[model samples]
Target: MKTIERRSTCPINYSVEIFGDKWMLLLLRDLMFNGKNSFLEFKASDEKISSAVLTEKLNTLLNEGIVTKITSPKNASKFLYMLTEKGIELVPFMVEFLNWGSRYNPNGGPKTLLEKIEKNKKKAIAELQDNLRSQRHSYTNNPSDAF
Candidate 1:
C-alpha cells in the first residue's frame, strides 16, 4: 500500500483523509453491493461519474490497497476490480453508513437490506463480509461470476 502524508495523528482524521470524498464511498458502496467490476460497469452507475474522475478514484483505491485489478479471462481487453482483505474490513462501516442513510435520507439506501441490518446487525454484517470474501476468492480462483 502507498502511504500518504497524514494531516494529523487522529484516527478520525486518517479515515476522513481516505473517505471524505463522496465519490470514494459511492465507489465502495457499488463494489460492496452493486456487483460492479469493470470500468464500463462503474461508469454506468446512476450517479454517472465521469471517466476521468472514475479513473482517478480507482487508481487511488488501487494505490491504497483497498482494491485490486485483475485481467478478465473472458476478455483480455478488459479488467475486473475486487476489494482486498483490507477493503473487506470496511463492510461493517458500510452497513452502518447504509443504516444511517436509511434513517436520515428519504432515498439513501435499500430498504430490504436496511431491514435485514436492523434485524440482526452482527449477522447481517458478517453475511455481507462473507459474501465479499466469497466473491473475491471465486474471482481469484475461477472468475465464473460475470465481470
Candidate 2:
C-alpha cells in the first residue's frame, strides 16, 4: 500500500480548510451577492443564520484573512465587514456551486444570475472581480465609501 503526503501548501486545500463549512459559504454569499455588511443584515438574510453562529463564522473568516472588519464611519458603534481579495476570488466557486445546485435542486436561486454565469463564466468572474477591486480601492481611499 502506498501512502500519499497531504500537501499543506495547496491553495485549494487551504481555502477549503478555512471556508468549507456550509454557513461560512452562505455568509460569503450574503457579502458577495447581497452586499451585506452589518451583523443585523447577515442575521436577517433569507437563510436566517443565528447570532452566535454568525459571530463564529465572521471571526473564522477574519482569522483566515478572507474578511476584514472596518469600523463604520457613520456610526462609531458598528462594524462593517467586507471580503478581502482572497475572499473575492471565491466568486467562481460560488458560481459553480450555484450552477450545480440549480441543476440538481431545480429551485435554488434566481435563475437570471445563474443563467448569466453559465452562459459567460469569464464575464461573470470579471464583473465580480471588477466590483471587488473597485469597492476595495474606494474603501481604502475613503473608508466611508462602501456598498
Best by lDDT: 1
Clashing pairs in 1: none
What are the per-residue Cα lDDT tens digits for candidate 2 across 15-100? 67766788988887888877787899998888888888898888888877778887777788998788899888888888788778
After superposition, candidate 2 runs with Cα above 4 Å error: 1-13, 144-147
Q: lDDT by residue for model 1 over 1-147, one digit each (tens)?
A: 556788999999988988889899999999998888889999999999999999988988898889999988788899889999999999999988888888889766776788888899999889988999898888889766644
Model 1 RMSD in angstroms = 1.8
Candidate 2 vs. true structure, TM-score: 0.83
Off by over 4 Å in 1: 1-3, 144-147
**Model 1's lDDT to the true fold?**
0.88
